[model samples]
Target: MFTIQQIDGAHAKVKTGADFPKYIQEIKELGVTAFDFLVSNGVEVYYGEEPFKTNSPAKYDPLNINENLNAQQFAKELKEHQDGKTDFPYFVKMCAINGIASWKVDLEEYTCTYFDLEGEEVLQEEIPGE
Candidate 1:
């Protein structure tokens, strides 16, 4: 089972069961490049930890950038994933670009926590059963 929680405008946390790795592999089979996955889905993707800079007398925008995609496409992707028609690597990448460290699994607890770019707990909650 799994649960996802939005931490903020561009960050979220996901808690998943022991089957996380398999889950990732399944999504990889979807054959979507990370870039295409994010843009097509309207989720923003970033490369590294540098904030964007604007030279308005030395004002720095957050180097890290976020995506602004079609909301309908995003919603459609979510629905497809829920129906088991798509994989989640795209979402996983989104989380990582936005600042999630790793999608590590805890064997004993059968769960994992996603951290935001600031290393803060964001998503945490398991499905009702399993």
Candidate 2:
């Protein structure tokens, strides 16, 4: 299992979405199999093998998740962020505006799925390897 400190150290290196693959690879190496991140407040629950799990407190103040699902705008912002044109905070604000409630990363599957406020998957993308 991974500690919050270790995860935080790994996460601190992520300045933008372009840095995500490296951060994911680092934490996955630390035994994090999966993690769900709440977009509203930055809370994250990390899972390891069976019976091993941990979580981190919210890193920021809560943001109201929009009810309308603006997939097109979200995709556009996501692409820009992924291209290294936006910082993490900016990307998160974009997510809130576009109605993303949370996101889950499956390290084994190399995928990240975003969900709406209703818990429906809005987008699922392959996570690029470092």
Return the TM-score for each candidate structure. Answer: 0.33, 0.98
RMSD values for the candidates in order, in angstroms, are 14.9, 0.8
What tens digits encode model 1's per-residue C-alpha lDDT throughout 68-96?
32334434543454455544555544443
Q: For model 2, name the residue pairs that clash.
A: none
Which one wins on lDDT? 2
lDDT string, candidate 2, 1-130, tens digits:
6799999999999998899999999999999999999999999999999989998999999999999999999999999999999999999889999999999999999999999999999999999994
Q: At residue 112, what lDDT does model 1 achieve?
A: 45
Model 1, poorest ten-residue lDDT window?
Answer: 1-10
Off by over 4 Å in 1: 1-85, 97-99, 127-130
Clash count, candidate 2: 0
Candidate 1, residue 11: how far the Cα is off, in Å:
26
